[model samples]
Target: MNLFNDAQSRSDSFTLDTAIISTRVYLVLLCISTGILISYTALTPHMSTIIIKNPPKKTYENLLKEYQSTLECPCSKIAILYGSFVSLSPVYHQVCSSPFISDEWIISSQGKSFTTKDSKAIQSFFIILKVYCSLTEKTVSDAWNIFSQSVLITSHTISNDELTIRTTDSLNQFESKTATEFKRISSLIQSYVATMFSILESNVQFAPYQSVNNNSSVNFKLMPTTQGNNCSCALNNECLQIITYPGVTIYDIGVIYTVPT
Candidate 1:
């Protein structure tokens, strides 16, 4: 019985020792695994990050050359109008605003023999001039709006001087085109007006002009003189001479009309 008890105690002791050894081994493996996990977590972020030392600076010219047409810089104000940058104010013929074109002047200028047809024709002439001026301004404004819509700024970082330098040729071309268009329209208007009044020949006698000392015959004068003082219509179509009629103090910068000779 004593031998059996001793053998049982030895067996239990051996089992406890084996269990302790297994527990120690498991704890050591767990410690090793936790250390590895912590190391991996600490290194992951740094592994993905990249650092550059003393990078070279890039210039606009160099970048433009490298990227060619594929490069683009965003603008803060993308939908700006041309009027914001440019102002187009047209100066109309002085006659349009002068007292000579007024209703009072027209009525006072008429003689006793002045027919209704003659009065109507004169009024219509002034009206045409005023309309043309208004239409020309509107047409140019619309053209500028369309041109502004088409313009694209490739670089937002560029200075105003640099942008102006780059776009000078394009702006000049647009101005030339606009001027050409204005000239064409002006020519058309002049031709139309001339044709409409062709029936009234230069030699034809109108109503007896009482405005100038009760003159019996009214002479329609056609003076082909241009603006003086280095005025070239080719360079500027608006360059016109101011004409003053006899016995009138106010100067009339006439577009189509001329002073009586």
Candidate 2:
């Protein structure tokens, strides 16, 4: 009976030792697993963030190869006005701004014996000239306003080379069309003025010049070549000639003369 009790006690002791060993092994394995999980969680987000932030930048050549003509860059200014990109400035005839068309000049010229009929004609001529200058500027401005409305830039986002080419083409077209229209209007004005004044009559003089200082009457010669300094009025009807008035005061007058064809 004593031997059996001792054997039972030894068996219980061995079982307790085995249970303790099994529990320790399980705890060690759990600690290793927890450490691996924590490491994975900490490193994953950092690695992913680095990848996202430091993406490789593409070169122009690389982008061109990938996207070809389909690639377009955004413009800084999306809706720019036509006036911002293109401007129209009309250079009017110099005669319109000269002193010859002034009230003082007209009043001074009125004292001549033959000035009654000639003065009226000259006044009419100057009035028409001034009107033409003003109207031309207004008309061109109106035309530009209308043209700007119609100018649809479909390329809000476009390739650099293509944008440049399109802009150049548009500018060229506008200039060419505007110049042609201006020339046409000028020809019409010239024709109307000539017809009204009977400029073709041989004996009828349009502008008679009497020198104030010399008291000499100078006949106005018909100029075969309407322009000087290698410039032709035929090419640009707005061509100006500088006329110096050497009398009481030396006045350098810039004048534009339109001869009827």
Candidate 3:
């Protein structure tokens, strides 16, 4: 009876050991399967989608009209000033046709006190105007209109809608000048743009007048031009993007300028 009991006990112990080993093998297989699934998931690439938003379309006429409106500011008035005729310089005209505007941002006496938010808004407007001025087929007169309009917009907008200063008749005499006189006025305007935005000053390469020939008038061209995606002008911090609607020609500067007849 003792011998039989010992044999039965050995058989029971073997069965238990076999069951334990089987469980361990099952656990090892489960771990290997889980690890393989994790590795496969990591190696796969998921598709991602992005959406872009754009601002309202702004035009020279709309901006001009906005500035031309009456303002309550006693210190500000709106006036029209025209620069002298740009001579018929084909090369210069070709340059003008390209979209190019000043990139400098030198704050004026008035601009120095602007709030940070106001400054950024005004800067954004300035950038928009610069690009617009460069892209449009504007003569000196056209450019002046756009510039003056922009000035008024900025002045009024930054002033918290209180007052705006426009070019009243006080500066009419300054605008009408002989080629020589106009050249000086142009220089001042150019200087102002350069002082504020460093872009246009360098791009405008002027051909000084030649006294030997009456036909020789001061001519200028826009340079350092780029095209396509290279022409995108936006502040790094801004979330806005510019989209050229289908059928619209996106203008680029530094390509070609035309001399006015």
Model 1 local distance difference test score: 0.56
Q: lDDT per model, in order?
A: 0.56, 0.57, 0.40
* TM-scores vs. true structure, each candidate: 0.42, 0.45, 0.17
Comparing 2 and 3 on TM-score, the stronger one: 2
Best by TM-score: 2
Q: Write down the TM-score for model 2.
A: 0.45
In order of TM-score, best first, we have 2, 1, 3
Q: Model 1 misses residue 194 by how many Å? A: 1.5
Error of 3 at 134 (Å): 43
lDDT of 1 by residue, 1-261 (tens): 122344455579776566667767878898999999999998885523233333233655565566556544545565544445655565766765776556676555553233544443554555565667677777688777667665545535454566677567657877788889888988888666654544432212344334454575455544332347765433444343433334433354334356221
Tell me the tens digit of each residue's lDDT in model 2 across 1-261.
Answer: 122344455579776566667767878898999999999898884422111222233554455566575555444456656666666666766666766567676566455343343444554555676677677787678678866654436634545577679777877787778778878987898767655644422223335544554765555644333446765443444444442222322243344333222
Q: What clash pairs does model 1 have?
A: none
True-vs-predicted CA distance for residue 229, candidate 3, Å: 65
Please say which candidate is ahead in TM-score: 1 or 3.
1
